[model samples]
Target: MRHLSTVDLKVEQVSGVTIVHFPQEVDAVNAAAIRERVLRLLNNGVTEMLLDLTGTRFLDSAGVHIIVRAHGRSTALRVPLSAAIPEEGTVRRVFELTGLSRLVPTTIGLPRSAGPAASRSCSTARARGRGRKPRR
Candidate 1:
């Protein structure tokens, strides 16, 4: 099993959204870790999540499962899940091929003028309107 060499989860408060920055390769070996972390945030009252996959280099079936499950759970809980994916990359291709690109809100690359920090702020504001608290 190929393990992720570096998996970092950073929580930032954006406008009203809790952006979970996932900077790691997501494969079979470490997909559970990502699931657990996201579940923890959901339990902590995160209703709006923005997954930033800017640094991810690879994604496998297990990784896709994790994302699908998260999306399912969010729907059941009435939460919103969005993602930031570059136009061209392994991760982007995986999502596209799996037909999950339509299921999740995905943006091509980072916001043009809005940096990560600013995006976080915008997300926070959006989350607030939905009556969801931003997770730390």
Candidate 2:
């Protein structure tokens, strides 16, 4: 993580993709700033983005707005944006309840130690919302 916590966010750049991870709850206090940072990244030649919400514990309309705007702007600019919200968590529920979940493209985040099998499992889940339950 690139620890950009001055605004309660972190950024990591890997394989030409910029990952902006939120480490704190997003609310009215930092929503606009977050939006600004994202826009700045987009304008400053960062094309690919991943909004990682795995660390986020709370959210509000402002938080959703930041994402909605990013999604819209990225779409207009033809840039790709993906989200990494846990398969099951409070943040996930907030996104679900507010309908943000449906709007954003998602990929499950897993620890580095999870290896290839874990990654494969998550990869499947991301393609069509949560993966199907195993049949009895």
Q: Who wins the lDDT comparison?
A: 2
Model 2 lDDT tens row, 18-130: 88987568888778778889988877777688887877888788888989999998888889887777656777777767666567766556333321213222343344445
**Superposed model 1: Cα runs more than 4 Å off:** 1-7, 112-136
Model 1 per-residue lDDT tens digits across residues 70-130: 8888888888887776555688677667766677877666554424422322232232234
Q: Tell me the TM-score of model 2.
A: 0.75
Instruction: Name the 10 consecutive residues with the lowest summed lDDT in model 2.
Output: 112-121
Local accuracy by lDDT, each model? 0.69, 0.71
